[model samples]
Target: MEGATPPASATATTPDAPSARSAPAGRPAVVVLSSLVARGSVGGRAVVFALERMGFPVWFLPTVLLPWHPGHGRASRHVPPADAFAALAADLARAPWLGEVGAVLTGYFGSAEQVEAAAGLVAAIKAARPDALYLCDPVIGDQKPDGSGGLYLPEATAIAIRDRLMPLADIATPNRFEAGWLSGLPVGSTAEAIAAARALGPGTVLVTSAPAMMHRSVATLLVEATRCLQAEHPLVEGAPNGTGDLLAATFLARRLDGMTSEAALPRALGAVFEMVARSVRAGSDELVLAAEQDTILHPMAQVTVRAIATPKPRAK
Candidate 1:
């Protein structure tokens, strides 16, 4: 809420701009809306690079801009004025290349109004191409050292995402804390996570950092209408931020490439895990996506996947 207005240089480009270029034969372009950090691989920086590296052209719009992730230190922040943001969204909605977008992936928002604008753009893309997918990563909060978690974003912005944008998503990737907050259910275990995913309203829900069956490990749960799959791997301590952004982009890219959710889950999880491990091993605070590009294309990290029983509904 307290940020400088984006500079004029950040204004929307015309339809003929390079960002509006079409995708290759099989890979349709993806539109990514998130934050941009000048020096980190978080938000749009991570999402755009990963999608493009996977052969999908990306149209990236920043919801906010910062020198680096706030976790680093105090820095200048820039958020586009609500009207200007809406105008840019309107421009994209009417662009002739709108039909080329196969998916729209949304994450952080600087304001509630930005959510409305982004929701409108997603609706426009869906209208232009009915098959287009929308994946929403509710980038609100994470678990704290005390084992409690809450939103890092403004309550109004989070409410906007939950009420307006989420219902429009075909798939949602939320961390355990976000899953619980969105569904108003406890997500302290795998069973509770499955229930919360089912209640989250998306056809597909991937809960990252889910409780694992094995000690000192973590799981990513993929919940659908009838079946749920769990992908577990060793947790990498001190893994930097942006893993979720990478996961969401990778999963969406895989889905667009015709990979089934069952198949994409493990691949995406493996890529994220490997990226984190490599970054931590390098003793870097940010993901080494560029140096570790091989991990994204061909992840060798092993992850175990299995079907999980969906919890039965409670009756009065």
Candidate 2:
């Protein structure tokens, strides 16, 4: 973690509401804990901006700080001392305004200790407000071009996320590799992804970069308590990082605004797709978040979402 700040309350009555003063006036604030970058839209930066653009105030906690995403190049990396990080989290847990947190979304972590601290903070928030939602984006790894690379984060950090933070999450967002790694199952097809997601134990799971029915297109798979959904859109090649962070944050925002997973899935996917396409077309190395803020606020891209039917029971 970089700079620690006391969590603050903010007002947001509606999903499309305008920003107001930081207070416990209306909608509860969303707390985002992730990595921060000075020159890129990844981790907390992506999550915070998307949430705020959707009219929700955010309490941002940086798990680490870098000049840019590691993929860009090596830069100054800062992880707050474990003791100080735990202390800050404890302070947040005891804050009088804990009830103001309507939801939380955690992405990349700097260390295994941070994952444990995050679980404690999530528990505290749930205690203060029983209805609060927690979305965990297990930013552990991605499928490389050949789809052979393994976990990007250290094994200890990945294990901590799987063991400590994931079970606490109401919703889990992981890419194909992460889903397979976490569940110890193959996710090569839609059915495999659904089974793996269910086995991952979250009430709901969103698997990005899922296999799609449409050739050359990518899909986002949403496996919830009732049904399975796939939102398919064209895959953008060489797209910038942080789409996962953006999607998780936006989806959580929509859910907080009372949208079901069925409804939220498309909008969140559309926004991410639009942003990625636009950024790629513009040939930017990083996500063109500021230039594409309009997409986040009001996505115009069309994403086809279809409910995947469960097979009928076999004859006895």
Residue ranges of candidate 1 with Cα displaced over 4 Å: 1-24, 311-316
Residue by residue across 157-258, what tens digits does model 2's lDDT show?
Answer: 999999888788899999989999999999888898888888887899999988899988988999976689889998789999899999998899899889
lDDT of each: 0.88, 0.84
What digit string (tens of lDDT, one per residue) describes model 1 on residues 1-316? 1122222322356765324555346789899999999998999999999998999999998999999999899889999999999889877876767768889999999999999888878877776677889999999898974876678989999988988888889999999999999989999888888998888888999999898887788789999987999999998899898999999999998899899999999899999999999999999999999999989989999899999987555665
**Shift in Å, residue 93, candidate 1:** 0.2
Per-candidate TM-score against the hidden true structure: 0.91, 0.90
Q: Which structure among the candidates has the greatest lDDT?
A: 1
Runs in model 2 lying further than 4 Å from the true structure: 1-25, 311-316
